[model samples]
Target chain A: DAGITQSPRYKITETGRQVTLMCHQTWSHSYMFWYRQDLGHGLRLIYYSAAADITDKGEVPDGYVVSRSKTENFPLTLESATRSQTSVYFCASSENRLQETQYFGPGTRLLVL
Target chain B: LAKTTQPISMDSYEGQEVNITCSHNNIATNDYITWYQQFPSQGPRFIIQGYKTKVTNEVASLFIPADRKSSTLSLPRVSLSDTAVYYCLVAPPAGYGGSQGNLIFGKGTKLSVKP
Candidate 1:
């Protein structure tokens, strides 16, 4: 109840459909991030939010959109899902930048056909 | 932001000390070395962090030399449960914003502890 949570832990969506991955954190951390993990590439950051209403793109942001309306919620949206987008997505939060420890959600496994 | 390099994989017998070294040649003055351990299908959990010299915790120890160009994560008497991917990251100080300011992950060293 007090940690980060991701909704729809497992999802299967058709290509070209829109999908959204939800991330909620109870810690009220200022920094929130979304990362996608694949077998060969490891973990690649997709987006990060510094605070409410401030979000920036990370290493891999194409075809994805992120919005942070409140400190507790940062949602990632895929406008047109592709098969290449299939991966395990992780959401993490930290109180501030620097050496702060990041608490992560369980992760959302998405499969696109 | 500094890029780190580490071994791709390693294996060790159980109850043996395992040391995984990470090299960060361009580490900044304010950067801090941090390590995280991740089991399969789970997000990485913070192991230990250090700025210089040595820092030990209940889980593991972080060793940084005077040059600050590299750091080592030493897990004493590792067991099968300790088998996981260990990531070494160089994090910037607070309020540093940039594309690379975020935690940049490397391939990570996969340590398999066998009994």
Candidate 2:
């Protein structure tokens, strides 16, 4: 079903550069989220969108931005990539905002040098 | 969201059943317990979820106590491929709080299955 897909599965960028990870879902879910996973730290939410044009900050939103111009796509932008930003980024979508199952994308591995 | 605590790591044999337990002593009434499995390079995948009692699916089973303070994810007949980090999360039902749909994840239990 191509449920959820992430682009640029791998990226190598330098510090001070900008990078955007794209996420697209075919389910047309109402909610989408961005998360980054690092070693020894489980997973932290970066940003989330309840609906198109409706976005909110998550636990670790600093230096990151998100936009949901369309329901099917939610992209995460790193304004200034840093070495700490080198982690596996994941995008997920849920049908609802409450107690719904979240389906995840393959993930984007970004390396900040 | 209730804070969850789980083992740092576990080991099991291929034919054994692995039960990973999680404790959320401060869980609220409306909170639901969910589990997710993540491989080395993939995103976490939802495994099973339950509010109370027991919920069974094709892949796994979730057992919750009456108080909802703890949960256990039981996997049957483990294999090498089942080696992954299993996360346990507790969050209130949507719209009840500010971080609705925001799943707060803690360091999960790393399961290692050997032949």
Chain B TM-score for all candidates, comma-separated: 0.94, 0.93
Model 1 complex DockQ against the native: 0.61
lDDT of 1 by residue, B8-115 (tens): 999999989999999998898888888988999888888998999999999899999999999999999999999999988787776535644356777689999988
lDDT of 2 by residue, B9-103 (tens): 99999989999999998888888888999898788899998899999999899999898889999999999999999998786666522774346
**Candidates' chain A TM-scores:** 0.98, 0.97
- Kindly report the docking quality category of candidate 2: medium
Docking quality category of candidate 1 according to DockQ thresholds: medium
Off by over 4 Å in 2: B100-102
Give the per-residue lDDT of model 1 (tens digit) for A13-97: 9999999999999988999999998986777889888899988877789999999999999999999999999999999998987
The candidate scoring highest on TM-score is 1
Assess the local accuracy of residue A7 in candidate 2 as a C-alpha lDDT between 0 and 100: 96
Candidate 1 chain B: 10-residue stretch with minimal lDDT: B94-103
Residue A18 alpha-carbon offset, candidate 1, angstroms: 1.3
